[model samples]
Target: MKYHVQVFVSLKPSILDPQGRTVERALSHLGHENVSGVRVGKLVEMVMEGERAAVEAQARALAETVLSNPVMESFRVEVRELAGA
Candidate 1:
């Protein structure tokens, strides 16, 4: 079976994000004052072929060990079986 996976990686709240702060400052400067406390993160999408349980396990392992930094970042993984594949 083939699965579609989405991995969302973000900095832990305890960590300061300079890039997010910079973007928020830029937006405020551009007259978007309502935009505050902005956070920037990454979305990774991929397709993998495996059994349902194995695919989920692989996605979690990849997210924990490769896609995110354990010291400062966290991640969530979503998996869906592809249709007609």
Candidate 2:
């Protein structure tokens, strides 16, 4: 089986995101006053070949241990099986 995985990694709410704040200010300066509280995060996409349960477990483990920082950041993992290809 083949799995398509997506990991979203972002800073925790308790952590101050200077990049996010800077982007928010830039948006405001560009005349987008309605935009506020901007957050920036990264998405990692990959395809892996494995059993369903095993692939999911591996994705979760990778997200927790490698893709995100436990101290200041958090991550979410999503997995889907590719069909027909």
| lDDT (Cα, tens digit) per residue for candidate 2, span 1-85 | 8888999999999899999999999999999999987889889999989898999999999999888888998999899988864
Best by lDDT: 1
lDDT of each: 0.96, 0.91
Count clashing residue pairs per candidate. Answer: 0, 0
Judged by whole-model lDDT over C-alpha atoms, candidate 1 comes out at 0.96
Please give the TM-score that candidate 1 achieves against the real structure.
Answer: 0.95
In model 2, which range of ten residues has the least summed lDDT?
76-85
Top candidate by TM-score: 1
Deviation in angstroms for 76 in model 2? Answer: 0.7
- Weakest lDDT window of 10 consecutive positions for candidate 1: 33-42
